[model samples]
Target: MTTIQPTHRRGATRLTDAGRDIATMLWRDTIRTARQPEMLVFAVVMGVFFLVLFNYVFGGAIGAGAEVDYLQFLVPGVFVITALQGAQQSSMGLATDLAEGVTDRFRSLPMSQVAVIAGRTLADAFRNLVGLALVALLALVMGYRFDSATGAVAAILLATAVGFGFSWLGAAIAAKVRQPDMVGMLSMFWLFPLMLASTAFAPADSMPGWLQPFATYQPISVASDAVRGLCDGALDTGDLVLAVGWTVGLLAVFAPLSIRIYTETD
Candidate 1:
């Protein structure tokens, strides 16, 4: 007699298989990242560039005008910015793989296809953690101090979460475009505007009235504010909630969308 397997048992089996596939893919990506150390170096260099340029060139004016230590204000924002740069790398890396026919090989395997993008994002998240740590250490050397060890940890974790969400967004773009150059250009379209227009480098109140609303409430601004509060030991519930909401919103919209686009791509 033909008998159907139990639905719950089948579901559990699928979940286990997916987990294994994701873990395998993650290991593959970690090895790839290690073989190519330049990727990590580039992320860290950009973070340091921003740290030095803003802290030295414009720090005095911004600090005096806002009545706040600019380094304190700037480090948290740089953390968020550094994390976002990791997202851009995910996009470019995935797009490069797609262009190079790597994903085609992946498609031929008997594995959960979503794991391909999922693993890359997770690997990039790890890279982001290391990059943020390096930036934080440099900030400490440059006279920035966290209010507490707990706050510093929380701030970095939150920034990494924000980056993970954005990495999914980047994956969606890469899966759809499948060209590294186009993906890089498209990334700039979203990244620079959100970055420069936000309160990352200065107070939103300093911007023109027309820009204040957006500069104050955008995802980057909310994330910067949340991380800043954490570092300062003055965590604001509203900023934290908004930052989390944005991250969750990005994941909800992009994770499935990227998976679908990837599977549908020729």
Candidate 2:
């Protein structure tokens, strides 16, 4: 009984220690963001730019036949897409740390190496929330309105989940390649098609019939559709359910790949 008690105590202590380490790593990554204010500025600038570009450049033509406001439709869609682009930033940041020898110092410590990626992804998600807020604010200024409070909240939560899930891919790339620039280029390869093919910028039904199916079913489109329905006061449980599934599915698949690469890399 005494020996069993001690073993249990040790196990609990190990978990507690792991939690602390992960927390510290998360703190460190967040602090890095604080120190580099330009990253936030960059996020805001890009977000606002996209909002303006789409609302002014394309909204009129796209919304011509629609009864609802195009800006409203666009805002949520843009928000989801921006959240994804923000995920690419996470990949680049992780790659930079690996290239800079910061990862080695973390590895040398008596800590859970997985905390490095976990901390990075969490911190990026936190930053993404801020960026998402900023974009939503700009959308409001541009006269995009949300009808459903619950939907608005759900959209924001799911969008951030998408960012969190997609960032793992970036982490995996960074961990494997150890090059920030390389991460950026590689991330674009996937992000571009996934982003452009979706209903974010345009209605999926308007797309070529052959392309429509692929665009409609992809994760980004699934998430964007959920966000659109939420902002429009139309509640679609299927989209919400599917969005959750994709977010969970992405994390499930890429997390281990990221950790394994981070572990194996010198």
Which model scores highest in lDDT? 1
Per-residue CA lDDT of model 1 for 177-253, tens digit only, reads: 98999999999999998899998898898899999999999999999999999999999999999999999999999
Where does model 2 exceed 4 Å of error? 1-11
Judge candidate 2 at residue 93 and give its lDDT.
88
Winning candidate number (TM-score) = 1
Models, CA RMSD each: 2.8, 3.4
Clashing residue pairs in all predictions, respectively, total 0, 0
Instruction: Report the lDDT tens digits of candidate 2 across residue range 1-266.
Output: 34434434477788888799889999998999889888877877877887899889988998897896778777878878888988999899888888887667887887888888889889989888898888888787877778866767777777899889999988888889888888888988989999899988888998999999988889898899988887788868898888889989888989999999888843
Candidate 2: give its CA RMSD in angstroms: 3.4
lDDT of 1 at 120: 92
